[model samples]
Target: MKFNVLNLIFAIVLITNCDIAFSQKLAVIQIEDLYLTSPPIENKKTSISYLVEPSDNIVIQYYTCILNDEFSTCKSDDLLSSGETEDYSISVSIPKDLAGKYLSYCISAISKSGAYLPSENECRSELITNGDIDNKNALFSYLNQTKNFSLYNAPITDAKDDVSFVTSNSAALSLSSEGDASLIGYGSEVTNAPNLPKAKEVYSMLDGFAIKSESDDAIIWGQFDTTPSYINQVEEIFPAPYAMAAILKDGGINTAGDMVRGGSISSEAQKRIDKLLSKDGLPKAIYHTAQAFLAVFDMPSGKQKLVAWGQSIYGGTLPDEMKSALSIKDIVTSQDSFTVLDNDGNAYSWGHSPFEQHQNIQTVYATRYAFAGITTSGKVKAWGDSYYGGLLSSAAIDFTNTNPITRLCASDASFVAISDGNKGVAAWGNDYGAGYIPSNIQTELDATTITDDFHCASTEKAIALYDSSHLFVWGDKKYGGALPSNIPTFSIANVIGNNHAFLMKAMDDVYAWGGLNQGGCIPDGHQCLSSDDSSLNLRSAINDLSDISQIGSFNTFSEFEEEVVGGFYVRGSGAVVMWGNSVPDGVFNE
Candidate 1:
């Protein structure tokens, strides 16, 4: 809690476990992926996916190590290498002896030269065991905790401290649409990415949606079903690189963003907002909503001003208190959470504050669930509980004392902070899976950051804009590698991430990877070109953008699916084309 008497601010999103390597070698051999049964047991089948350099012969070995505090090998298997395309899949059997125990394992590829490359789970997985909690001991349990996940039923409806219903005090948190697209109110218990709020049948469901993405939910703007005239007015106010947004048109207000199109604010929230907007009315909305933080730019009294709102939960509405607490400046959401920074350089934080106590602060950077602040003394402070060593780990915190962090981006579990001094990037967080960044690219992320005025983005992975506006990536390659071998880097106007990639090239062209099977990234009428190697939506409007003003992308991730499973995209021109496993059949067909 150190104070330097200066002001500063920061954005949150969660991530899936993934790692993709970017290599530039004469011959590269990589263990691209390894998927196995969740909580595996005896006789269950396990799998591995990998990549080998072109025309190279390689051998892959599956190695297993003891789970509980070990330093010894358990079993190993050597297998023939396919040395095939990036999307190859292979399988192995789970040993019965490892049932119930968490064993660490990995796949190593042996090159024709006997050179070996090892996968870094040093890979870990747990198998269901025969042991069960003693029934007598369970009877005396404290919270009646179960084996793993537990659901608390008959939830008390009233708790003064409960923030979920804090917006009940407002009139908008519960409102539904009346005229067009009325069915956008509720659904048949559909699903989205893990931890992502379900899509309500309202325009607000589209809040924070974008056009090219790697999310796990489907966002089909009104244009997908029936075109709405108000869409024509979207850009004049809510413009490019849009985030969580609220719109007022034809006597109605709805939500908009990179991941969704339009939906109504809950009734309670609307009422709360009605009170505040009694004089001038609700403002248009955010340009793009990342990290779930919302903001609007307005010209009050002839000068352009930024108005921001914080902590917009499900239903795309912020609590009444948040809007009321807003002041003069604008703030963007961290990937899906908030990093509270004040004008006095003092930060108020709870559980795991990323800042060091008694350290003067300059600014704070928000990870999906944590916060990292740059002290005026040029050091960093990360607060909040980190699930993996990827975040705030000693290896992740290797910041040089002389360099100051200039900007940052977050995947669901990691952080990519750029150095102002041109040294390199400071990245840490769920360093496994697609979030696993390439070792050599660390220099690229750093060089790209210090050299350009660009933005960083992520999903299960991460990508940053290089000097040419073309992209330089680390993290997982499914989304990162999807970038065409020859990107028109100099023309890239904007870029964002779901750890998958979406870009605005030449300020007119668009390219994406991750959710094309569902039409999330592919433009209409165009053949599927997703980086994940699926060909589903090749005839949608998004695939055919020309003279387009701007683009936005959205996605959700399912830990249960163990992969990003849904996505959709939107145009600043009001085109809402969606694609993903979660999308309705023929939803985006012309």
Candidate 2:
């Protein structure tokens, strides 16, 4: 039915029906992304946003139940005002008692006579409650959304007065319903800011000695100071000096010492790196420690150009003779050695390697003094300073010739791998005081993702994202395995092991299961932990944080301190939270 707004104003509007009725109708194409400005609460002015439709009479309404459910109250009739803009918004006085809950909305170009528009995804996210999420990255994957965010309150860093729940899928952010902007409050200004990269390509990293690569929102993580000098005398190939990661552990090997920013690699060397990484080789990142510096494939072209700081300024800078030599699928650099995985399913070692074989390798990792590899067929391989680890040739199993290993992880003294197609886990190394895969690790892999590292004393802690979608750890009864058993089992979205463990849950919360002491690892008294000190229990480290969108590890071994392993997470609110080391810093809690 068709009726103009002019006639509708003369009569009162009700929830079920309207006064006018006509034969013609207006169709609502579709409502794009919904940007919620008001914190999901009642009794305050709230805003909902969407783009404009061709129809002159666009009505936006909300219902008590689902928008699909009939007989719901009209939140506002005049909320669809987006003057001079393609985007539009509706602002209405919110009723009290709707805090921390989802609100459904409906928008339509219905006849003035009152009709609903049937659209795809009709009740889908027409409204999203800005409440905390319990599972940021669940296995069944609720949102299946991998987001990276950074929060900013112009006048203040933590301005929550006029909050907006924004996501990467947003079309445009609106500050208020003041204009045709579909956004409300401070968020509109945020989207309109200059140089904002659209979705997908939004994340970036910048690091280099004197020279660095960056985008508009690039965040400079870690710390290194250096002068921008290169080659025999100085070549400012990189604009910034020591601007990024990869500072050599032994700076004395370079002629310019720590002052040297970066060096050049042979064009031919670049080609080898490209072919080796093949489809997986995106862009080689800088890698180094206090004693080594490597800018793999360092050139404008993704060709031959890899340079390392060794053997005098550019030690391992490949010569033309070795240009087509080796294609590396992946690279892992320990404090003094490097393990390169070849595309042909083989492993290669240089500087220091305990074993010379790399047959059918799938993935590789290096501990402070040892190396480990997983074969495509699902088997484990090991080498290097075995120390207390049975990884030595004398071990009973044939690690070198083993095959069918699904996954592999390493620590300073031990090696762990998944076998039986992830049906079980096996560990070989020192496990006296640290975590060792309890005999059930094989059964543990049934529905889980492994995240392990050389925890305390090569603790060999086993951390996994379980089938139930919760984070669980075991191994050395002294490190992660010793976590309290009473920790909640809601959802453990992401985890990283750094001699200790850091677990990220939904709703901007982070937990840690680490401490040098024998007492509880939780800084605050734990609420849900078992009394048994031998059980693996995680303690809440930080809570009520911004929603988490992404998780990653951040480790630096040189200058910072001894074996300081940490991690970083991106919150839906766009804040970066870092945890590691006991040192004090404004960017992260030590």
Candidate 3:
């Protein structure tokens, strides 16, 4: 039999497969270049081609590997028949996580008997460059894949070689050149050339020569000569030449010889300066100037001082201390009537002073109608009608011609007197029922002072002890004798009498009995009164009030009178309140 080499080769492959009953033909698979639909050329779907032999029943498989780990294995079954050679292609999805260089799979045919043929491999074409190449000349060969060449180990040359030189030293040129070169150098050569106009050169030379001449003139005048020209030249060179002269003068430079030796003004000129300094205003100016100069030069002066002139009336540095001192003596109310001391040390009264009860005055007595004052020398003076019976009468049985009476008091028709030796209370004037001095009070007792109210009929019922807090009552029980069952045991602070009796407790709260309309018992809240109850309506008129510190009344019948034409007077902290018959307008001046 005549045999073609290609047919003989195919027959030998068939004969080697005959022992297995069915020939398992071998095929070669190749993935030369991978194409992808997505950007980053490596990321597109990959299709593979394979060469299949005749009589081969082949299956193709596809797989992707990640981080050198196998991920997906897929197969296309029965792709080739026995003894036939063919090309087959398959596509695979590129996994998004598959990056950098990877060994992508292109697997060959598997025999019909379920045996896989070996797969062919290719060198890893990079999916991504991994930044191992020079960036400036990195070719973006496929718009996505980068072709990086090894650059650092490459030989350096001035010209391009067989291997393309990405970077060349030929692009650089020297910046220096030999003689008479119009092209000075490479790079920024145009900026470095020396260029000057002829006019500028001439002007520069003239300016330099002028400066040197001026400098020489300054040196010659300042060191060699003493003429006015030289002085003016020095002044021109050094501004404020007086300051320079001062320095020179301080250095003891005087004559022309001294000036030639760079010295200062003479001793005679300095003496004139001293004389000027001794002058009044001149010294002050000089001192100020010196201080200013020292300050400007940052120099210190041991005796630097500031002088001021003025009288230190309130002390040089501290303030003065001078204040006024004053005090209060006695407060006289506007309602108090006027009374004068007579030549015989007796008290003479006048006016409608309801506080004293209308009466003419003679000697001090214990009668209720009368109020009297006894002199410190023991002389007695009396005034007003006698209220406590004949206690003020010169004919009383117990009454002695004592030279001096210490004190005396009077209630309704009653009077009480106190001498250094004896103490007694008496009653006289208009009696309201039992308004008389008690006989029980005639006991021998020493009294330092005595007081009574002629206006209160209730006052005639009781006599208050001098130092003791006890009260002695000997008359009718109808008036203030009806003490409340809960009367507090208190020391009597005071007893004020009007139509009623006002008992002031030690706590200053006042209690009253007998009458309320006569302004007798000034209630806690009521203050002043206007008219007497003697006219039409029998009601007492009271006006604006705040607090009452004291009150006084005269006759009981007068206090209880149906018509009070004249009313009570009251005093308060800021002003007085009056509402009686004779109330004046704006009495407070407020």
Comparing 1 and 2 on TM-score, the stronger one: 2
Give candidate 2 regions above 4 Å deviation. Answer: 1-257, 260-290, 294-307, 311-324, 353-357, 360-362, 376-378, 388-403, 420-422, 432-435, 439-472, 476-479, 506-509, 516-543, 550-590
Which candidate number maximizes lDDT? 1
Q: Predicted candidate 1: what Cα RMSD to the true structure?
A: 25.2
State the lDDT at 269 in candidate 3: 37
lDDT of 3 at 394: 51
Candidate 3 segments exceeding 4 Å error: 1-339, 343-404, 420-423, 427-435, 441-468, 473-489, 507-510, 516-590
TM-score between model 3 and native:
0.26
Error of 2 at 580 (Å): 6.0
Instruction: lDDT winner between 2 and 3, please give it.
Output: 2
For model 1, the stretches where C-alpha displacement exceeds 4 angstroms are 1-203, 206-339, 351-359, 388-396, 421-423, 433-436, 443-449, 467-469, 479-488, 499-507, 515-546, 556-563, 570-577, 584-590
lDDT for each residue of candidate 2 in 514-587, tens digit (9 for 90 to 100):
43331113333343232322232222223433455444322211222233333232233433333333211112
The CA lDDT of each predicted structure is: 0.36, 0.35, 0.27
Task: Identify the superior model by lDDT, candidate 1 or candidate 2.
Answer: 1
Report the C-alpha lDDT of model 1 over 153-270, residue by residue, as the tens digit: 1111121112111010000011112211212111221212112233222222221121111222223332222322223223212221222243444322344333332233445545
Best model number under TM-score: 2
User: What lDDT, from 0 to 1, does candidate 1 have?
Assistant: 0.36
lDDT of 3 by residue, 9-52 (tens): 23433444354434266343323232221212234554443444
- How large is the C-alpha RMSD of every model relative to the true structure? 25.2, 21.0, 61.0
Model 2 score (lDDT): 0.35
